[model samples]
Target chain A: MNGKYRFLLAALPLAVVIGLSGFFYDRLGKDPGELPSVLIGKPVPEFTLPGLEDGAPGLASADLRSGTVTIVNVFASWCAPCRIEHPMLTALAKVPKIRLVGIAYKDKIEATRAFLGELGNPYALIGADVTGRVAIDWGVYGVPETYLVSPGGEIVWKHVGPLDETVIRGELLPRAEKLLK
Target chain B: MKFLLRLSSPRRRPGPFAGRVPLSARDPGLRRDDARGWRALALATVLFLSAVPALAIGVDEPMADPAMEAKARDIARGLRCLVCQNQSIEDSNAPLAADLRHIVRERLAAGEDEAAIQKYLVDRYGEWVLMRPPFEPATYALWFGPAALLLTGVGVILWRRRHPATVPEAEALTAEERARLDRLLKDEDPA
Candidate 1:
C-alpha cells in the first residue's frame, strides 16, 4: 500500500511538469492576435446599409450571396492600416471572377468617398456602415479586417489587420483560388 | 532679526511639548506662508475631487428615467470594449466603447430587457464581447480547471499522509553467510 502511494507521489510531479509543458507546447509558434472566428463556415450575418456613394443602392446580405466567391473588406478611412492595404486591395480587384465588396466601418460617407477618390476605388460595391451595427454583426473587432466568403455566402476565411504583398500572394490568393475551384 | 533668528533656530521651545507653537507667537511671515500653502493644497484637492465626478458623469449622461439609466449602466459594465480589449465598455473612454454605451442606453430606453440586450450584443460580437463569460459547455474547463487541479493535489497529499513509508525487513541470513560475517568480525577485532 505504501509502495503504491510512493509511486503515485513520485509520478505526480513528473505528470504536472509534462502536462504544463504539453499545454504550452500547443501554444508555441501560434499567433496571439489570431483569434479563431466562431462565424467561420457560417453564413454571413444579415444586414442592409446605405452605399458610400450618394443615391447608390444599399448593400444587403443577398448581394454577397451572388453564387460567386466574394472578398469583403472592412475598412475605415480613419484607420491607418486601411490606407496601407488600399494598394493591395486595388491590385486584388483586378483578379477575374472574384467580386470585391467593401464595408465602410464607422466612417462618414464624405470621408469614405474622399478616401476612395484619393486612393482610387477598387471595390465593386461599397457599403456604408455609418452606425457600425452591421460591423458588429460581422464580428469586426478592428478596421482593415478582410473575409473571404464562398459562393454559398459562408465565411470560409477571415484575416485581421492590413494585407501586405506576402499575405496577398501567400494566403489570400491561394484561399480564393481554392474556393473558386 | 530676533524673530527671524528664533524662526531659523533649532532651539526646542520650553513646555510640555505642544506639537506646534501658536501661529500668532511664531513669525507672522512664516505663518502667512503656511496659510498660503494650505489654501493651495485645499484648492488642489477640491479641484481634483470635482474633476473626478465630472469625468465619470461626462461619459455616461443620465437617461430620462433613473431606473433605465441604472439598467443601462449595468449592461454597459458587462460589455467588453473591443478597442481597449481589457476594459469594459462602461470603464473605457475609447470612442467605440462610448458608442456601445450609447447603444446600450438607447436599447434600455427602447424597452429591451437585460437578456435581450445581452443577446443582441452577443449575436453581433460573439460570446467574447461579454466581460463575464456565460456558463456553457465550451467554458466548463476554463471555469473548473483550477479547482480540479487543487482537488487532485489535496487527494494526493491526503493519500500520501495516510500511507507513510516503512523500512523494509532484513532477509534471514543463511548459515554460510553468518559464518562469513563472524569471520569478518573476528578479523577486524584481532588484538
Candidate 2:
C-alpha cells in the first residue's frame, strides 16, 4: 500500500469508533418511555363509552369532529401520574374552543367520582372504560397518556407519559394555539 | 502428572488452603491441558444452544378449539409486548401483553385471519409491534447492513492477504562471519 493509503488503513479503528459513537449519540437523548404513535395523522377510532357516572355526559369519537380541536386525556384513579398531572389538565380545560375530555381507564365508577371529587373535575365528558377495550382501540399501553386531535378528528400529537408544565406549554399549547387561530 | 490430569474435578472440592496445586502455573509444556479446556468449551456451547428454546416463555390459556388455539399461538408469537420490548406478547406476563392476547383471541374467534388481526395491530402500534419488521425502504439498511459489513470485511482481509507489506532484504554475511558461524555450528558440549 502507498504511504498515504497506509495512513487511511491505520485510522480505520478510530473511524469505526467515531461512527459507532455518533450513531448511539444520536439515539441517546430520546426518552425510551416515549414511543412514536402510528395513530398520528389518522382519524380517532370510533366508539361510544358509557359515562363514568349516570348523569355525566359520556365521551365519543363523534364529539371530537364538531369542528374543534380536542385534547383526550387517558387516565385512571389508580395511576399516580394522573394525580400529578391533574392540575395541568384542569388548566387545559379552561382554554376556550379546545375541548378537553377524559377517559377513566379500567377504574370503577365510584372510584372515578371519588377521584374527581378529591382532585376536582376538569373533564367536560368522562368515559367509563372498565375493561380498557376503548383504550386498546386508542392504542394506549399505559395510563396518563394525552392525545391532541385535529378539528377534523385526526389525531395530531401524543405525549406518552405524564404531562408537565414544559410539555404542555412548549408542545401541547403551541400546536393547539395554531389550530385555535 | 497423573494427579494434575484430573482436570474434571470440582473446583470447590480443593479449597484455597487445601490442595494448593496451581497446575497451570506448575506445568509449562503440558499441551494436553488445552484439550480438556476445548472439550469443556464445546460441551458448554452445546448446552447453551439446546437451552435457547426453553428460554422462550410459555403462552397463556389456549382456545377451546385445538386448531384455533394453535393459530392464535402462531399469531401471538409474531406480536411484540409493548411493556417489555424484547418479549413477544405470547411470552410476556405484562398486563398490556395479556390485553393484546385477549384482543387477538377475540378477533380470531370473530373469523378474522392472522394477517387481518396483525394488520389491525400494526395500524395502531406501527411496524414496531411486529417481531419482524416489514421490508421497506426505511428498514432496507437494517436488513442488509450485517451481510454487507461481513462481505466488506472479507474483501478487506483478502485484499490485505493479496498485497502483503514488503519486507527489507538482509545484507549477505562477510567471509569472517561465515567462518565463525560454521565453527559455532560444529562445537557441541555434552551435559
DockQ (Cα-based) for each candidate: 0.54, 0.64
lDDT of residue A34 for candidate 2: 62
Clashing pairs in 2: none
Tens digits of per-residue lDDT for model 1, B69-123:
7778888889988778888898898877887888888888888998998898787
Per-residue C-alpha lDDT of model 1 across residues A9-49, encoded as one tens digit per residue: 79999999999999999999676655567788899999988
Candidate 1 chain B: worst 10 consecutive residues by lDDT? Answer: B1-10
Tens-place lDDT digits, model 2, residues B1-191: 33444555443234454447665445543445557766777898999998876554344556889899888888999999888889989889888888899889999999999889999999888889999988999999999999999999999899889988778799899999999888888888422
Q: After superposition, how far is residue B122 of candidate 1 from its true place, in Å?
A: 1.0
Interface RMSD for every prediction, one decimal? 2.0, 1.2
lDDT of each: 0.84, 0.86
Candidate 2 residue-pair clash tally: 0
Which 10-residue window of candidate 2 chain B scores lowest in summed lDDT? B10-19
Model 2: residues with Cα > 4 Å off, grouped in runs: A11-14, A17-21, B1-61, B169-191
